[model samples]
Target: MGDHFFRKLWQGTAPLVLWASHFFFCYLYAASGCRRETWAVLLGATLLALAGAGWLAWKAWRGGGEASLGVLHMARLGGAILALAAIAWSAMPLLVFGRCG
Candidate 1:
């Protein structure tokens, strides 16, 4: 039971965690003085985060057919979707300004 709980919890939170990490990296990079490579690095991070969140959403969507787990699956899926949106939103400044302000 404990293992199952943990697994579900991870599935629900992994994408958010990835987003947080990406957000932290973005701020850290900006603080480090927007170097010439800042745009490229930020783009890479954004793409990676998108891929991770998308994958997590896909996994949640394809979750096991156990009826008892339906709610958990939905929760995971919702979290992944939220993470994807947040990750994209956070990258918007990069898209618009193309560099640190």
Candidate 2:
């Protein structure tokens, strides 16, 4: 039961988890009044999340079965791309918000 649960969990959820975490942090930082230090923290966190997403994408691309065209593999790739886009969207505010309020 334990192994089966874990196997299903790891099938293709890395990007989703990372995206949620990134969203939470970005929201927290923004709601903090966008302090001077928020820029540093936000940039750092975004970069770190981007790196993680990139890693997951690489793994998804390489870990497929002998069969090159599979639904699960394509889904993982799509998820990774969506995650990257979400991270970029969240990072955009850093440039839009002129300064601390």
Candidate 3:
């Protein structure tokens, strides 16, 4: 019983952790009010985070067959795409607000 419960919990949470980081990182940058430098930083950090997540998924895949790297990897890639989009979206405010002016 406990085994099944823990297994399910872990299964559910593993991807959430990977995805949540991207979400949180974006949220942090967004809430700070957009700026050109910050936008670049956010984009760079997001790419690095995505790369790290990819590495983790690859490691998990190569480690054992029981690991669900597919779900984790998909979640990571989706999160990264979303983060990139969000960062780009946030950049609009900076650009419109006359950072270029």
Estimate the TM-score of every prediction: 0.88, 0.83, 0.49
Best by TM-score: 1
> Can you tell me which runs of candidate 1 are displaced by over 4 Å?
64-69
**Residues 16-55, model 2: lDDT tens digits:** 7898999998898778776678788888899999999988
In model 2, which residue pairs have backbone atoms overlapping below 3 Å?
none
Tell how far residue 76 is off in model 1, in angstroms. Answer: 0.7
lDDT (10s digit) by residue, model 3, range 27-68: 787678756576666566666666655555554445445544
TM-score for predicted model 2 compared with the true structure: 0.83
Per-residue C-alpha lDDT of model 1 across residues 18-96, encoded as one tens digit per residue = 9899999988987789778889998999999999999998887777578436777777888889999999999998888
The alpha-carbon deviation from the true structure for residue 71 of candidate 2, after best TM-score superposition, in angstroms, is 3.2
| Per-model lDDT | 0.86, 0.82, 0.56
Backbone clashes in model 1, listed as residue pairs = none
